[model samples]
Target: MTNYLQLSNITKTYGHFTALDDVSLSVDKGEFVTFLGPSGSGKTTTLMIIAGFEKASGGKVEVGGRSISELAPHERNIGIVFQNYALFPHKTAVENVYFPLQMRGVSRVQGLRQAEDMLSLVGLKGFGHRHPKELSGGQQQRVALARALVFEPSLLLLDEPLGALDKNLREQMQIEIKRIQRSLGVTTIFVTHDQSEAMSMSDRIVVFEKGRIEQVAAPLDIYHRPQTSFVAAFIGESNLIPAIITSGAGKTAENPTLGAFQYAGDDALADGQKVTLLIRPEHIKLSRSPVEGRKNARMIVETIVNYGDNALVIGRAGDIPMRVRVLGADVVIIKEGEECCISWAPDAVFVITK
Candidate 1:
């Protein structure tokens, strides 16, 4: 089967600086993929190139085996939703959604009917008559989304469309967007720096760093089996301890300060090879005394951040900083400037050689 979208060794350069370096990937039909990275990490650059807004200096972009490398932005038949809902002030919500079809010579009556159907799909059934200025921020966003999908484009690209909304609304739209995308089965590439958003929405996430693809995997796989140190640290809160493989065949590593950590995995590494150990904050249990049946360490509690239902305890386990997540109710048992026992099972440990 042909790939829905294929980016082959895409490269972008501006004079002397390189924005993207030999980046290549493929997206399956109806697949929801997220491009996740920090600022200047080339996620949006790749999105723009795929949309035909920023031409790649090299390589080809194909949709269903047809190269669109030389096509204009509008010629690509890709729907894009921007951070700012780019709606015309004069156009009503239905008109805004109708504009795409209108550009294709859709009649006002037929286009308005199709536009209203899309608006209803996005939960703006009765508000299609209002202009962009009259609609709420969230409503305007819905209009923008409806417009993007009205044309039945081959691919949909979302460029941080939820960035302008508040926390709750942003989260609500995440679910709504996912629902609509699944209903339409449109191939999508969503770009955002928010790891939680990526974690919650994407079928697979493409991690980008310094203009390169770091790793591409399912959300849980990316979190638990990160391919690089950058991915382990970027995806979520982690305690990364530098260690050396004591006995590679034994699946054990020795940290200078945290002591020995027995890992659970079959990795091929030479004995005494240097590696990084990743233990998530939630995996560590804090206690007043050493926990039984696990690797234990004494940490001096340096800080406690409470979040109603859960809390993060940041401290030092020997010279290495450690973070532990605990129930908010249990946080009352520990105080900063005091020593607490932190423990984790062997399976909680992940080894990153790179």
Candidate 2:
């Protein structure tokens, strides 16, 4: 697939502080790509550089195989939607949405008609007359989205677009934004600190850390088979246990205390080499009785937390804490301070370096 937008060796530095470090990535035509990371991780800075708000100190920005590194922000023909909406309080929704078209010398009547259609597409039909303060947070965001799309730019950039809404509203807007992007078939780059939001909305997620790209993959691939310890820990809840490779049979590792489990691959790992095993909470199982003919580890139940649909059981194997996720409706509930064994398939344990 051809990429619609590409950032090649892009770097941004503010004196001694580097906001983005030699970041290189490409967004396929009509594909939704999200830059995900914690605060100060360079996700937003990368988006700003792509939008031409921040100039790259190195490398080039390309769109449709054309170099856009020297293009001005408006000349880049990129539509940007910000968290604050950035609407004119006194202007009505229609006027706000038409602002971009007006700047391009579009007639008032044609601009208003186009803005009206954009609002209707975003489910804001008949809301064009409302002022910024007259609408809710979600409605204002919809207006901002309409404004961004009215120009029909080659790329759409969203910077924490749902960060201003409540949790429920944010989720709803995520679906709305995804549907709109799919229907419009516009190449989009979304920036957010919320992992769940990015996973739910993007065709692919690019995980960033400390001004560098950590890993970029589909949501499921990144969640289930993380390439780095940071990617594993940042994307979801995981139980990391320190262990050493004692054996490699059936492509598995033998933990001195956790027993033997299948390894991901037949890599040449030296015996007694230290490694960290990553296991998602849901991958673990707890039982009171040991099953015969099975190699597994035993742990003492330390705590149990019931959260509506599921229960989080915290257990201790030796001195390490392990968490198990189980159905809330299960008949067997392990009490705190009780003894239980936690076992998992070898394939479920992901080995990572420190």
Candidate 3:
């Protein structure tokens, strides 16, 4: 199927700094895609270009296979929700939602009815008469969302919509936003620097860096099978170990420290070539008794931290710090500064180029 939205070879620059560099991506219809990265990573810049708030220095923005570069922001039929809940203080909740419809030439009676329905859809029934100041942060966000959807735009663009709320409210709103988007089947694009938020809500995440695309994949794939070292480090907590590819067949390779491991299928580095191995904390296993299967894996526990639900065992292999997360019944009665052997399956280690 053709993508509902397409950004082709897009580039954006501001003075001496480049905000986006030949970034291209596609969003399928009804897909919830997120642009995720740290500050100044060009995630928000890409969203602004797509929303027509900023013009691309090069390339084109397409919606539903049609070029939308020349169209004005209002003419593109896209709804945008800013970080701050942009509700008018003087207007009631219903009036704020109805404003969008009224701008499109809908009658007062019809706009009010539609706005009321939208308020109800966002779980704010009977809140039409309330002003922005009277509602909680979550409620205010709901109103802002209702206003964005009231116009029935072809696409929805959320620019850190939950950034202003407290942690608890932000999480609650994330679930609500996902639920509402799924119910409406709206093609949505969310921009955020929070990895957890993107992982929870996105069908796929596009990790950006210094005005360029770093990696684009499903959350699990991005975490476990990152194509670059930057992606493995950015998406989640990982222990990066520098190793040489000793031997291999297909994607499986043998490392000196972690023993035989599997990497990307396209990895074709020669033997003795320096490569970095990405191992997640949860992937490393700790055993009080001798580990029977891992003869080639070399590791020794250096420190242990009890964190209630789980224990973080810091292990060392050569000069690198290997973190292992022990949970469930396995975490019972493990003291800090104790010696324990740590090992991981060959397939659990993903090697990436530095």
Best by TM-score: 1
Which window of 10 residues has the lowest lDDT sum in candidate 2? 248-257
Candidate 1 ranges with C-alpha deviation above 4 Å: none
lDDT of 2 by residue, 253-349 (tens): 6656666666565467777777888899998777777655444677888778889899898878887778889999851657888888777776777
For every model shown, the clashing-pair count is 0, 2, 0
Query: What TM-score quantifies how close candidate 1 is to the native fold?
Result: 0.99
Candidate lDDT scores, in order, read 0.94, 0.88, 0.85
TM-score to native of every candidate shown: 0.99, 0.95, 0.92
- Consecutive 10-residue window with the lowest summed lDDT within model 1: 1-10
What is the Å distance of residue 255 in model 2 from its true position?
A: 3.2
Candidate 3 accuracy as TM-score: 0.92
lDDT tens per residue, model 1, 103-194: 99999999999999999999999998899889989999999999999999999999999999999999999999999999999999999999
Better of 2 and 3 by lDDT: 2
Better of 2 and 3 by TM-score: 2
Q: Model 1: how far is 179 from its true place, Å? A: 0.3
